[model samples]
Target: MKWYALLVVLMVGLGLQAQEEKDIVVKRTLHLMGSTFEISVVAPTEEIGYINIDEAVSEIKRIEALISSWDENSETSKINRNAGIQPVKVSRELFLLIERSKKISEITDGAFDISYASMDNIWKYDGTMDKMPTASDVKASIEKIGHQKIILDPDEQTVFLQKEGMRIGFGAIGKGYAADMAKELLISKGVKGGIVNASGDLTTWGTRETGEKWMVGITNPVEKNKIYSWLPVVESSVATSGNYEKYIVFKGEKYSHIIDPRTGYPTKGVTSVSIFSKRAELCDALATAVFIMGRDSGIHLINQLDGVEVVLVDGDNKIHKSAGIVFDTNQYVEK
Candidate 1:
């Protein structure tokens, strides 16, 4: 054989060998970030897969420790503790997360606010709520709920809550951020394929054991054990926000337990909102924001954004989707 042809053959062999290294899949699930976190990694051997999964899990736990609002020593809690008093210096990692969160709040117009922690659970869904909160109390409940109140100092790497009683919680976007971070860690370590599912806010990279794209399904908001639609998700993130089970009925109006930070009231009109994006954190936040924005407004906002799609289930069980969300009729199931 010619020397050049031999070199080409050797290069192809080496490429195939590298591809063969990650031949098997290993998936592990555990309770983390206040929800079930599943990590799947494909490696040359089962042991390497386990190792990658462990490192990913550790990264997620570290993130949980940093931003957990319930932890008194967490950076987020520290910022809340000193609300209106002083700015609390935080790690650069935490600072960037808060800064991105603030930008999302700005884009969504406060529909997705971390400062929503000030909201009171006056609207319960566990068969206890009977009357609406007084207007004044409702106003007071959201007094400190404002994303603009969160001041971030990049130079100092500090976070400050403008109001004394204001607080921030990652319950809306923490898991997805954790998932994103975990995926990055695993990918950096040479894992050929993996998935980081934080509860239902999940992100996937590469293919499964069968070498096909990841397929995700949206749960039917109107029917149990049925799905509204399924889509192929490849190297992307998807998150859904809804009060399928938790809701209250007042004067023949159904209200979900997802409280709107702007109004300090339960979300209505839209039943469920699912968002697809490249960032898990963004998808998680947008799901909640779109639910609050309702059908038309939510679809409009999603259309304005790039590389994002949404599916909204309205009160009448009608499905509304964004421009890019072209459903495969074969995968679509009706109520």
Candidate 2:
């Protein structure tokens, strides 16, 4: 599971008129899709709020059934099973998701790839490895991993992998996509306000019960207990990728779990990457991509795109932001 870099800070007031039309914020935290999910919604009454949360949970489960590569019966698993032999027909929704993933792969210059699931587990950060894998083995680990090799048939809605061992997984963007879908479902039902936070990759729509925008606290990677800034989010998504939690130190150098599929090596020089975009899926993929791209190049790419912004923390624990991001200078606290 991805580290939780952004925390949803709920701001509720104590003084309120009893007769006023109050929108209650109801929230539930549960384990889903192998990660923690916090679903919140505003409703006219407590009873209705619970109902809406239940509906949102059901919608998330439905999406997991469709996209989870771990389930052997899922469409993604079928595509992986049929790799190199034949094309497997899938739902149009799955096909489109794969299509968008491939586009991101191209945009990031192969830094982000869904086929990274095909990589061999040569380097372990679980305290099992004392030395780095040989260069040849490291290179061979990514032999079957390439998003460019995934072939899609639009008319038939079929996906094929060029290599037999090739596979695809949505570990990076799946939760964000699920969060977006849940938020949209609530919106369609006329729910005015809510937040679907899939372990830090979160989306918000409408206002809080107090009519204020949702506040997302960006945690300091160096000091996890402290927040560096508060971002007001309205009808937008945010995702953060950080390597401070799980990593291995080899020869006094740190290697994180997030690997670069292109080079089959762990990325360096960046501690955390947070991307803000209109869609959670985009933010999710770009968060991982930009982390692998390093600080300067990541900022350069984010500046080129419209409706996108980035805030990154370099290895020295310094904060960097894109052209559009504005944060209070005094709020930044480094190690």
Which prediction has the highest lDDT against the true structure? 2
- Tens-digit lDDT track of model 2 for 8-76: 333333222232577677788989999988888878988998899888999999899999988999999
Please write out the lDDT profile of model 1 over residues 1-335, one tens digit for every residue. 00000000000011122344347767788998767776777677878889898999899999999999888888888898899999999999889988999999999999999888877666666687789889888888899999889988888888899889888998888888999999998888878777787766888888775576677766555564455566877899888876666777779887777888998877778767778899999998998898888899889999999999998888887888999998765654432
Q: Give the lDDT of residue 220 in candidate 2.
A: 64
lDDT of candidate 1 at residue 253, scale 0 to 100:
81
Off by over 4 Å in 1: 1-22, 220-224, 331-335
Q: State the lDDT at 42 in candidate 1.
A: 66
Q: Give per-residue lDDT, candidate 1, residue 219.
A: 57
Q: Model-by-model lDDT, in order?
A: 0.79, 0.86
